[model samples]
Target: MNSKRSTEILVGLFVAAGIAALFVLAMKVSNLGDFTDDKGYEVVANFQNIGGLKPRSPVTMAGVRVGRVTGISLDPDTYDARVTINIYRQYDNIPVDTSASIFTAGLLGEQYISLSPGADDFYLEDGDVIDLTQPAVVLEQVIGQFLYSTAEGD
Candidate 1:
């Protein structure tokens, strides 16, 4: 009876360990494990369209991630999408004239914001607005335009 009880206890422990491993995997896959509030300054950029860009999407600079999209809203007056990004404090030297463009990771991958720094010597400050912006390019629109042009040529 003693040996049987020890075996049962070991099985329970193994099951618990498996459950913990699964939980960690889920958090890592969904990007919820590294939650921290000190993400640094906030910057806003207005886009004509934001295709499938969600909150917590990465913000990259020259192909390197430097921040994440914190929020997205719409401007009722201008009818534009306002994207709020939180840049890391370590990358605070981004130029004021930097441009933000929405881009896809692959043909069907996730959408993210890409920042291109400008020649300006001044750096961006907290709550600054990025004036130069490019909206996301929808694949269907591009295909429609291509088909229209092809039919017109025929």
Candidate 2:
């Protein structure tokens, strides 16, 4: 009887470990497991369209993640998408003239912001606005244009 009880206890512990592992996996896949305590500096960029970009999307420079998107809103006057990015304080040397563009990871994957540094003596500071920005490319619009052009040619 004691051997049977020990086996049952071992099975219960195994099930609990599996549950904890699944919970951690879910957090990582959802980007909610970001354990960094870097409060970072905030910067703004304006775009005409921001496809599927959401808060917590990665901000990358040369394919390296430097920050995350903290907020996204619309400009009441210009009607453009205003994106707030919080760049890690360790990357405080980004130039003032750096340009930001939205890019997708794969054919139909998550969107992120990529920064291209420019030749400027000035470095971006908190509350600085990046004027040079490019909006995300909508695949539907591109396909529509391609189809129209092909039909016109025929």
Candidate 3:
């Protein structure tokens, strides 16, 4: 009886450990584990259309993730989509004239902001605005245009 009870306790511990491991994996996969101490710096960019960009979307530079989109809102006066991004402090050398473009990782993957560095003397600072911006290219629009052009040619 004593041996059986010890085995049961070991099994319970194993089950609890497995559950904890699964919870950690889920949080990491969903990016919820990025609760670091660094608050980073915020920069704003306006786009005419932001298709499916969401807060917490990745902000990448040269294919490497450098930050995350913190907020997205509509500008009432300009009627444009205002996107706020928090660049990690380690990537503070981004040029002021860098261009921000929305891009998809795979054919139908999530949208993220891609930064293209430019030749500029100054570096981007907190509360600065990135003026050179490109909006997301909707797949539907591209397909429609292609079909229209094909029919027009025929």
Across 34-99, the per-residue lDDT of candidate 1 in tens digits comes to 454455899999999999999999999999989999999999999999999999888989999999
After superposing candidate 2 on the true structure, give the runs of residues whose Cα lies further than 4 Å from its correct spot: 1-36
Better of 1 and 2 by TM-score: 1
Task: Report backbone clashes per prediction.
Answer: 0, 0, 0
Each candidate structure's TM-score, on Cα atoms with residue i matched to residue i, is: 0.79, 0.78, 0.80
Name the lDDT of candidate 1: 0.93
Summarize candidate 2's per-residue lDDT along 55-81 as a digit string, tens digits: 999999999999999999999999999
Which candidate number maximizes lDDT? 2
Cα deviation of 143, candidate 2, in Å = 0.4
Give the distance in Å from residue 9's predicted Cα in candidate 2 to where it truly belongs: 20
Model 2 local distance difference test score: 0.94
* Local distance difference test, each candidate: 0.93, 0.94, 0.94
What is the full ranking by TM-score, best candidate first?
3, 1, 2
Top TM-score prediction, candidate number: 3
What are the root-mean-square deviations of the candidates from the true structure over C-alphas? Answer: 3.7, 4.5, 3.7
Q: Considering lDDT, which of the candidate structures 1 and 2 is the better prediction for this target?
A: 2
On a 0 to 1 TM-score scale, where does candidate 3 land against the true structure?
0.80
